[model samples]
Target chain A: MKSWIEKQKYIIDFTLSSLLRRKVKNIGLLILYALIVFILASVMFFTHAIKKEASLVLRESPEMIVQKVVAGRHDLMPLRYRDEILKIRGVQAVEGRLWGYYFDPVFGANYTLLVPPATTATEQAETEPMRTVVTENEHRHGPEEQAMPLVGAETIGAGNIVIGNGIARVRNAGKGEFILFRTHAGEGMPLRIKDTLSSASELVSSDLILMTEPDFRRFFGIPENYVTDLAVSVRNPEELSTIAAKITRLFPDSRPIIRDEILRTYDSIFNWRGGMMIVILSAAVLAFVIFAWDKASGLSAGERREIGILKAIGWETSDIIRMKFWEGAVISLTAFLAGVILAYIHVFFTHSLVFEPALKGWSTLYPQFKLMPFVSAEQLTTLFFLTVVPYTVSTIVPAWRAATIDPDAAMRHTGE
Target chain B: MIELFDVRKVFNTGKPSEYSALNGISLNISSNKVTVLTGPSGSGKTTLLSIIGCMSRPTAGRVKLSGREITSLPERFLTDIRRKTFGFIFQQHNLIKGITALENVMLPAYPLGERHGPLKERAMHLLDRLDLSRKAHSRIEWLSGGEAQRVGIVRALINDPSVIIADEPTSNLDTKLSYRFLEIVETFKKDGKTVLITSHDPLVYQASVVDEVVRLRDGRLEGEAP
Candidate 1:
């Protein structure tokens, strides 16, 4: 009792029991307060987790992409630019990429089509074949299907195609099924599906369609000398920017998109979306603050009498204020912790059903993936600021007013 | 001694409904004796007791305990003085509801921030001395009228102040209980504590423990208290 901590302990003890005395009213407030915290925390967790997942998927992408610009817009880059980019001092390797977007009139959705470079005879000769090896899961398969596991997606040949799980799902096509496509010349060309891409990388490859370089070039009417862009890899990661600067200097019409820049763009998008969601939810927070203020300001008759009794029995105004402060603290903190735990479960475990639309719109291929769990000190601090500070301040002002009255007058309300 | 010099108290002063409750009053009582203030309604007995009890300030006047003026002190210092020097038993007992009798008795010392363990022991001792040991854990609404009144008395003494002020302590009590209250006041007087009481009950002022009876009429003191 001689120390400040000892004093607050007794006050907090009284506050808890006093709150229980009015449990019906207090619990109502706790539920509403926790609900607000849950919303704010859930959005924060989902946004951060999605951004982290995006960066992780981007880690495997090219170090830098050099795209040709025509009148400030993206244009096809010629294979001749690959030779110049390869001459950069730090450039490890450079390859022309063939990728484009196709819109299906029937489905009214877009698909990403890509072409994997042909594996050279020397590279194929150096690799081990999977035809002789049988994995543990192969024992469960029938003998015929296990003779050779499905051809790897990267080694598929012409007249054959590998599609992503999302494309396979929406097209209702499976292995050995033929998907017909309309070429640039308005002619129908059907390619046999080899296999659907693995679900592990589904977050990025969900809407992907892969074909051989010859089929891609012939179907899209693209010239053999031109490709979509150039994928550049640098030997020294620190010199990636230097190589990119060299590429830009050699070709003034080139735009270099770095992996880190792409990652930053994803982070900024998620942060902006999460912040906007919170700003919209600020109305609810404001309503709760006003509700708390009203609850404190309009003290019931019994409550006023209790304050009077405390003061009349030698307790001071400061003591009453302290008691009220503890009451607010207990309520707000309990609500805050409960909300944060629930939000974590919702975002990571449940996949945040309410906010799943942000991942993909109604018409797009929705990636079926779980977000990694993320919790930070900044999020908790923001929650405390939004919920605890306002409610506690609202209560103290009214409690002080009730306490500052004369004990006798407060007790009887007669101004005696 | 507890002394008052030319005390004047006006409620809502300068307002349309302003009215004087105490007018130019002065009084003194010895350090270790029991004194009774008896008066009709609106006679200013409670006002005079409140002023001397240090629960409020006087509009104009001076009050002293052991020859020290406290009339003009700030509310904060007055509260400290009140907590250390006086205990009050109101007319209605004023025990906070929803709490046990033991908690109500311990309320006065909470501001002093006394350790709960020793404070609880002291409160139990007081309740036991008043024969309220069995009812210590009972809620306020569950206690009998006499038991609640004694609970108020124990709460008043928990701070162990030098002065005890009981306003209408016997107003809600039966004759037997009123006599019991007088017996408790007799013990307080024997313990060398100053006691002031405002009451309409004859059993209080007529008790053998009382050393003087001061009366009031129409906002003015009578019978040697002036």
Candidate 2:
């Protein structure tokens, strides 16, 4: 008799060839497995990439933000809170972040508004115009009309306020126009547009207007001493907690939010997505288990006899078991690879359109971004164990039965 | 060498209609000879063959093969005995229809733990001996009845088992092919290997090459005649 390893190789080789002989049947199984894998990989890849991007953004955000709470609702922080919080140790820089909400009647989304200082020449010109912010439908307004065209933070400058590009395209305003803009309080303010912002941000970039904090207060009828939130930068990263604690003690009305806490809120969305994927994938896996069980259990007497004959010819029960296991391995590995590739194309290349409908429910549109869906060795290893190992286990019972069959009874079995 | 003593095989144990398939039969088969076991349907010819082939064990008997008492052994150990010592040809061709004739022949040799290099060569050699080298790659579904039977013979002989058991190996073959198959069995016998076959055809009973014919009537041997 041969060594066990040698015997297993022969069995696996024969099993592979036998499967090749029934390509039609095996390929059908492969495709079915692939569909399950594809869906799973797609959802996993999209959610993973989104979380990765969000985390990257959060890591680069300010160390902490201070907001005022009024009966659990975030309200405008009084201007005096900044001076009091700044007295806390570990505070390096304190700046006001003017945040508000506005409704873009054209596109339906809870649009957050913010005011950041004009950091560039283009923005200096944009703030000069306190007119209507026209995003699209340019012909609806005269060319002389001053309009605030929403743009991105990167394009803000002195005397300029950039509204979101969505607002520009929707309102159809260009450079050097007077546009009427409304404050959160429904007060209309006239301003001359300097330039249109080129891009947007996930939080407020797409449908927001950025101006100097002082200008924002004047436009919204808020006091010079008022700010929606205060962004605090720590002199030492290690001092964040001490600074937060100090601010909490000094200013009871103001709450300091650490960067990680904000990131956690973002992180929870991914955890939810992950939980959903598990539930959905587990259902698919159950279906696959049933399909595989039915297929294995349904082997005819002739098939069982074939197994017996193979064993009688010197093949071990382990060999027969391995043969079936390889059949499963081939199917699952191929499906896994194919599915991952499709998911890659969907995430990185196609922007995950197919998945958006399922994931983005109630949102005006899915977030605009591309995902890398990086190939992590950990993920692949985990996926391999998830797919191939269970399938191999599933084949064991059937293979054992077939291998242990009575050779004489097996020899007598016919198709009939 | 093979021996059977007081072999009793009962089907559907401990039931109202329980009946013995093989009842307290005893026999011995010498190595390097041809033994033909024949009987009517339900006479336990197949049951006896099954025990001799190591496919099943006698419920209340002792069976010895190669001087080892195999009846008491676990089926796991008997598996190797069946693999290395017994080659079986059934009433049906029993070739896997999806595979080629050569693959079918190589099926039995798989347990020998030979590498592909040797298994393929051995399979090819056996196929050639059976005058099936040209049809080695032919699918079982495409093979003629004679060709398929020859494939079955190749499969049985590929592992070079010491004992060859044929259960109506000619049932599916025509007269010419049946005679040809018998001639092949005779050749195996001449090679000093043991051959046990069951057949209803008179050709087997009257064959000049047969060493002995053990006639069974309804599960009891009439006589072990020369």
Off by over 4 Å in 1: A1-6, A117-154, A168-178, A186-193, A198-200, A235-246, A296-298, A359-362, A410-416, B74-76, B174-176, B206-208, B223-226
Output the TM-score of candidate 1.
0.88
Sliding window of 10 residues with minimal summed lDDT for model 1 chain B: B217-226
Tens-digit lDDT track of model 2 for A219-257:
667776777788888889888988888887787777889
Please give the DockQ score of every candidate, comma-separated: 0.47, 0.51
Model 2 DockQ vs. reference: 0.51
Cα TM-score of candidate 2: 0.87
What digit string (tens of lDDT, one per residue) describes model 1 on residues A118-235?
3211243246363221112212112223222233334677889888778878888888999999999999999998777755456666788888777898789998789899888889
User: TM-scores of all models?
Assistant: 0.88, 0.87
Residue A135's lDDT in candidate 2: 43
Error of model 1, residue B65, in angstroms: 1.3
